[model samples]
Target: MVRALSFCAASPPAAGPHRIGAGRSSEVFAEGPDRVVKLYRQPFEPEAVVNELAASRLAHGFGLPVPEAFGIVGRAGRTGILFVRLDGAPMTVRYAYNPLGLLPALRRVARIQHAIHACPAPGLPSQHARLRHQIEGARVPEPLRRAALAALDRLPVGDRLCHGDVHPGNVIATGAGLHLIDWQKASAGDPAADVARSELMLRYGRLGPAWFSRLFPVRMARRLIAAWYVASYRAASGLPNEAIAAWRLPVAVSRLFGRPSDTDAELLAAIAALARQRPDSESASLFSGPGRSPGRGQPECCR
Candidate 1:
């Protein structure tokens, strides 16, 4: 059964609130000293808001460090969620200045992700179902799409909580500790699948325009960060490389459904290449070897 929560009416118009952050689908506003409101853009789905609310409550009930979800609110003809604001810099911004902190930061992310998977998330949508939907809808070549669907079928189904999107940007480092935000994509499924999604985002997920990503230094830094993250997660989860790799195709397809950007071309090509290869092909070699890729001994970024 779907859990229901009431929506509170906003005191001030949505546009009047001081904006703190913005993402593809929503804009976060500082409602007060201890709370914030995330107002979705026009034409947003109410179902998504409901899912986030229930998922946030579930994570909090498990004693996770997620913010307390006060309730939903309507402001300026938009739906928003009221949450306790934890004032802290996103892990991404923190790492940008001190690249040397990359590995430990990723390790911390791994621990938090693992802890999320340890809790049961009943009443949440199924990750497999969501991925299957994405695979069916992805605008990839037909063969690759079908192959991804087949791969999804072969994977095991699980009830463990999966933070659909667990990237550094979504994690906040407060004085109390790290708090995982953005529960909109949370689901219940195989923990390996969730880890696989994170790996794809950290490694190949486009950060910005293709032109900016083409720079040698930027590309190298991203690769190093991604490689270290995968390594750290592998060590922490004790899950074999193959287990995570198996979910790559499906996860890649799902990523396509996100807001389109200039980097879509490269992402599509990568997905197509993986789809053509056999499940056990040498492509899995990407996850093997020290540091995952041939690079200088531990780049100063992840010191």
Candidate 2:
């Protein structure tokens, strides 16, 4: 615990601690101007919080846009971490009300993702290790699982900082710019795999009620936004689209185990499609030659 603060209610009772945001794993409550507490819901354990605290401090020390994690605190039988409160609405919430901002917000997040990769964080856990563990344990067919493992073994390992997860909901739109939250999944690895994970989440990760995302227009919009995000990242990093596509198969497989049921089918179909394509012998890339690529077709980054 680094400068830990007690969880008991503080002064200014008129505007006391209250819930500011809620997610599947945790609820955030504002403690004061400088700090907020992210309280994990039932069946919580200390390991994730411990990881978040370490990862957050490391990211902050590296001058990344991550919030400073203070330490862990217990309250009402739940575990929470105190963080330097950031003032902003999540990028997804902002876009929910202003659909027009969707493009710019995604583009900005792409740049943020690229910037994150530029800063190396070798002290963090291995992204490759996590992918291997998850893919081996995923519910996909054995052939697909073996293919994913082979694909994982083929991709180049890197030492760049990886957020591991970067859906729109994880980014906050602040006055300064977009800030990334949720550090439990932070790790160090290839930027391409990280970008693939971001693309997968943006394209299929659930944001709201399933009914809303199932709508035809909403589904199309999700595809466009995800494509735009990749285009932006490609422009900034000059990382070949082939590399990102190669990573998509394994990353999608790794994500299937614990995601919402709505995302599983799409991921499975995409994984199967990528696996069917005979990759280049030299590079083993599923993407090649002028075609926009299956399931990942979108606006050209070359423009």
Query: Best by TM-score, which number?
Result: 1
Per-residue lDDT tens digits of candidate 1, residues 76-185?
88899999887676776556677788679788888778778878889999999999988888878888888898999999989988889888778777778778888998
- Candidate 1 wrongly placed segments (more than 4 Å): 1-15, 287-303
Q: For candidate 2, which ten residues in a row score worst on lDDT?
A: 1-10
The model with the greatest lDDT is 1
Error of 2 at 247 (Å): 0.3
lDDT of 2 by residue, 29-89 (tens): 7777678888987877577688778777877876777788888888677789988877777
Q: Tell me how far the alpha carbon of residue 225 in candidate 2 is from the true structure, in angstroms, after superposition.
A: 0.9
> How far in Å is the alpha carbon of 179 misplaced in model 2?
0.9
TM-score of each candidate structure, all chains considered together: 0.87, 0.84
Instruction: Report the error of model 2 at residue 60, Å.
Output: 1.4
Model 2 scores a C-alpha lDDT of: 0.73
Candidate 2 deviant stretches above 4 angstroms: 1-17, 280-303
